[model samples]
Each structure stands twice: as C-alpha cells, then as structure tokens.
Target: MNVSIIKYNAGNVQSVLFALERIGINAVVTDNIDKLQTADKVIFPGVGEASSAMKYLKEKKLDEVIINLKQPVLGICLGMQLMCRFSEEGETNCLGIFDNNVKLFSADLKNTKVPQIGWNTIYDLKTNLYKNIIENEYMYFVHSYFAEISENTIAKTNYGLEYSSSLQKNNFYATQFHPEKSSDAGQKILENFIKI
Candidate 1:
C-alpha cells in the first residue's frame, strides 16, 4: 500500500517516516499533490509553530488539497492542531477538518508547565484509532496548546484539565501527542491506522 507522509516546514517528519518503516510500511514524504491524493493513507505529521506551518501549507496550496482527500488521513501533533478550526497559538485560522478550536494551556495553573512534555495517559477511547489499545495507556505528548473536548474528540487526556488528545471526524483522525515516539502502544496505533 502507498502511504504518503505530508512534508512541510514542520519538524518530526523523519521520525514519523522511521516509525512507519519499523512497522514495515515504506512511506513517501512529499508535498506533491498527486502523491498525496493517490496514497492509500496519508500521514500529516508536524512539530512546529501554528501560523508558520499554516503559511507553508497555504503557500503550497496543500491546505486545499488536504481537506479534500477521500482516503483515511492521520494527523500528528501540530498537524492535529492545524486540522482544527482555529488556534490560539498565533490567532491563526486552520484547515477546519474538525469543529474544535485549539487553545493555549493556561499559564496560571499552580504547578504544571505550559507545554506538557513527556508521557501522559489517554483514556475514554472512542475511535477505531484506539482499537486494541487499553484505556489510560501512556502516550508521549509535547504541546502548549490543546483542542477542547468537542463532539469530535475520540480520546481524552489531562494535564491541568481534560482536553481532546485525539479526534476523529469522518476519515480524518488526529492526535495531539506524537504516537511515533510513544513506543509499543504507539506503534500499534500507527499499525491500526494502516489497517483502516
């Protein structure tokens, strides 16, 4: 099967590529429209600032191409944030695949950090993406902004308060955490996505 990883000005593309390789899937990393449209599955992975990433996608016109894809699409980290309607990070408008909006974690929280980096448990599993994955399984996360729990939220996580860690709307699936870096459970989630 042809799996294409959307390449942009974002970080962590190589790590997602390698993660797919370990799962025995040889995927292409490209911004080419044809390559993306023809893939059996598309992975949109990002680890970067919101506005800049949105700028690059719009500049390449990939912003339009991504929303129109018929095949299953998986978005990671900032990719997930970009899929939302808007982001608080830079007051940027996003692709709007999901109805929810991304917001910055409050700095006024007593002890927790803004960007919740490191392992966190994901529960309330609600999509095929979490098939076979147990509740409260640890997943690696690194983000300052988060999507509020909405009708599209498929999984939930709590740092200071609860938020959508993963979301699904139609064929689009997204994770605020980096599954590629989450270890065995993460691999399973990726494999499950390939199967879908």
Candidate 2:
C-alpha cells in the first residue's frame, strides 16, 4: 500500500515498524520527501521531547513536508504533540495542524502520578481512527504532557484531569496514547488508520 513511516531523530519508530509488520504491511521508514509525499499513508510516530524533535524536523525540512501532505497522516504520542500550535515543553512552537497547545500536567494532583503510565480508557470517540473500537477502550499511555481538549479533540481521556487523547483535522489524525502498545484495541486503531 506504499505506507511510509516518517523517519526522524525520535524513539518508537522500530516498534511502530514492528506493529505494521504484525498487520502484514511492509512499510518503509524514511525521511525522504518524495517517499513521504507519494505514500498512500504516512505514520508520524515519536517518543521524545518536543523542542528537540521539532529542531530535527526543521533541520530536515520535514516539518514543512508533513504539514503539506494530502494523504492521511497519523501522529503518535510525541508526534501528535508536535502537530499542535505550541508545546509547554521547552515552550516550543509546533506544526499548527491542530489548533491546540500541549501543556504539562498539573503538579498538585496528590493521588495521580505524572506521566500516567499504563492503560487508560479513551472515550468520546470520533473519526475513522476508532472505527470498530468501542467507548472506554483502554489504550497504553506514557506521558506527562498532554494536548488540551479542543474543537479538534476526537477522543478524551482522564488521569489528573480530562484531556484530548486523540485529535483529528482534515488529513491529520493523532493519538496521545501509544496504539502500537495498546494490544488488540491498539491493533484495531492501527488497522483503521491503514484503511484510511
């Protein structure tokens, strides 16, 4: 299907590659502009800090390329954070695909841990990304920073507070949780994305 995974200075690309392999899709991981532009779909996956990741994207001019892709694009975790207007992490500016900001979780939450690791339920599902998935489906998450609920939020999750766990606008789709690590529900999300 000519699916392409955006290659950059970020973690999680290998795991994403393996996830796609599990689905029997042989996808290419590349930073080449042509490969990205011509792919049937593009997966922008990341597990890293926002500012540095944006720096690498800018250096490679991938930020521009990613913003212009007409084909459906999915951003996972940090990749989704970078797709927003700005990030509280290092106060970095981002791609502005989704008109929202990434903010750090409140430190005053006595009972909740920062990063909110492990499984969490995602509800308020919208978009094809969760086609066959039901409400309150648990997805793997590992992050302290989160995208705030906005007009673009397709799904919401709660930890210290409610936040946008998934977002969509036009061709861009994103998940704050790691669908690649979320088991069957995660696999369904990935399969839906591939279909898109």
Q: Model 1: residues >4 Å from true position, as ranges?
A: none
Identify the candidate with maximal lDDT.
Answer: 1
The 10-residue segment of model 2 with minimum total lDDT is: 107-116
Candidate 2 similarity to native, TM-score: 0.98
Quote each prediction's TM-score.
0.98, 0.98
lDDT string for model 2 (38-151, tens) is: 999999999889999999999999999999999999999999999999999989999999999999988787678887899999999999899989999999999989999999
Task: Write one digit per residue (lDDT tens) for candidate 1, span 1-196.
Answer: 8999998999698899899999999999999999999999999999989999999999999999999999999999999999999999889999999999899999887678978999999999987789999999999999999999999999999988899999999999999988999999999999999999
Clashes per prediction?
Answer: 0, 0
Model 2 bad stretches (over 4 Å): none
